[model samples]
Target: MRDADPDLFVAVAHACLLGESPFWHPRERALYWCDIPGHRLQRFEPAGGALAHWDFDTDVASCAPQLDGRLLLAMRDGLWRFDPASGERRLAAKPPYDPAKERFNDGKCDPQGRFWVGTIYEPRDAAAATLHCLTREGLKRKAGGVTVANGLAWSPDGATMYWTDTKAHTIYAFDFEPHAGELSRQRVFAQFAPRAEGQPLDDYGGRPDGAAVDTEGCYWVAMFEGQRVLRLSPAGEVLREVLLPVRCATMPCFGGDDLKTLYITTAREKRPAAELAAQALAGCVLGLRVDVPGLPVNVVHV
Candidate 1:
């Protein structure tokens, strides 16, 4: 059931080159995300409407908060423990792949406090990127056979896991054993048709990007270049479609005190001049009030 009325507001004005990985800090009551190409990390407090950001040496792909005051950052080089207040970062795990070819992309901490991160193959030639998980032992490769790894999210009960390969236009689901952190029975949750040759941009439904699951267990995914977000049922049915005011909808996360604020990050880097001009909020963070609340962010157990 799609909502006929579509409305969204600009929550933050930061013009990120490629904004992604949005997560809410329940304790701090703030939202944090990263700009991959811009090499920046940003935080926005909705209550006060305060926006703060920091520049980084490498591309900060994704991030999650820890029990302590530090943040777990998945950058191009490796996973880092970053202290936002002191601007200090300590290398947590070195990149398993060549940094020049692949880098971390979408990720979040699982409900069990395990930090999960995905990588993107810059060359776009093959399925060379992989998904990784960080626990007390160390970082380990969890899955592969993906080019642009994204849409990492666990179901409400943490019994099912979701992942996406943007290049393949497919969202995959796995039977997740939460206690053991094991994934099994990988299957296609949903798939979309790619844009045909010489097809108009407006006709393209776009590719799957970052995503999140709500309390109802519906997977909400941003459709990159689709100018929309999709709410899919547990059985992979499209329940709702959210129209965005931009070309590239990178990611969506639930925020606010009630966890009903849907914040969407967009992209502008390398976009055509005409498209960028048409969508002035291309790289801005947008928000929409939703009825269903979201699960609280699980802090990384470092």
Candidate 2:
């Protein structure tokens, strides 16, 4: 119930263009995240204060760790296997949507070791995006009628799945069958009031962007343009809200030795010059200590 203001600190000072998809690698004791608009994958070693980056020719939206110590990346073009050690990349599967209009966005691996990724319809005109599950059987569509598919996470018991559409200001829950990688009984989990037309930016409560789940089964989600992140209970009640120094808080993940450190990524790309000037920490990676730890990341089987 305590506020996050006193515990928060800067974990990294790198100002990313559009930071997203933060993943904590437990074995390596490192944090990995993507700068979507910047078309780069970044790694930060907290112990030594070392930072590394991998520049890509296409937008790298999200990624999940694999059992082979490589990373399964969901890029603008397709699914790829990237070996950090060798600096090599290989195509795994081509994108299911049209490369011109839609591209992969937020994604993560399910408990069953299947990579679940979603697309973002660039036009933002209609809900044309789809979410897909990638496994040994190849890519399969799991859900559709989405605009900006994001906030992908699962419950602690692995029986429920959560997803969000930022443009719609809604979060959804599904009855998940982990063994079969199926999602059913889709329903609204949380719904925020949309910003009124012509309303000032400060008056906006913001919409859902990215998310994570803690050990207590509570959902932690970033509220883009709201300047805050929220911890919501399983039934969709807000338990706590953590204010951030940045307006576009994109995503959050738990890391550090005990997994008690909460790291947040923010966006600076396309932001107004006046807003960026006032918020010096707008695009930096922010962190804070938390009471509950997060679940261990699921490794992709690919």
RMSD of every prediction: 1.9, 1.8
Report the error of model 1 at residue 238, Å: 0.4
How much is 14 displaced in model 2, in angstroms?
Answer: 0.6
Q: Pick the candidate with the highest TM-score.
A: 2
Where is model 1 more than 4 Å wrong at Cα? 1-6
lDDT of each: 0.91, 0.93
lDDT of 2 by residue, 1-302 (tens): 12347668999999999999999999999999999989999999999999999999999999999999999999999999999998899998999989999999999999889999999999999999999999898999999988999999999999999999999999999999988988899999999988999988788889999999999999999999988999999999999999887889999999998999999999999999999998898889999899999987889985
Residue pairs with backbone overlap in model 2: none
Task: Give TM per candidate.
Answer: 0.97, 0.98
Question: Which run of 10 residues does model 2 get worst, by summed lDDT?
Answer: 1-10
RMSD of 1: 1.9
Q: Give the candidate number with the greatest lDDT.
A: 2
How does model 1 fare in lDDT?
0.91
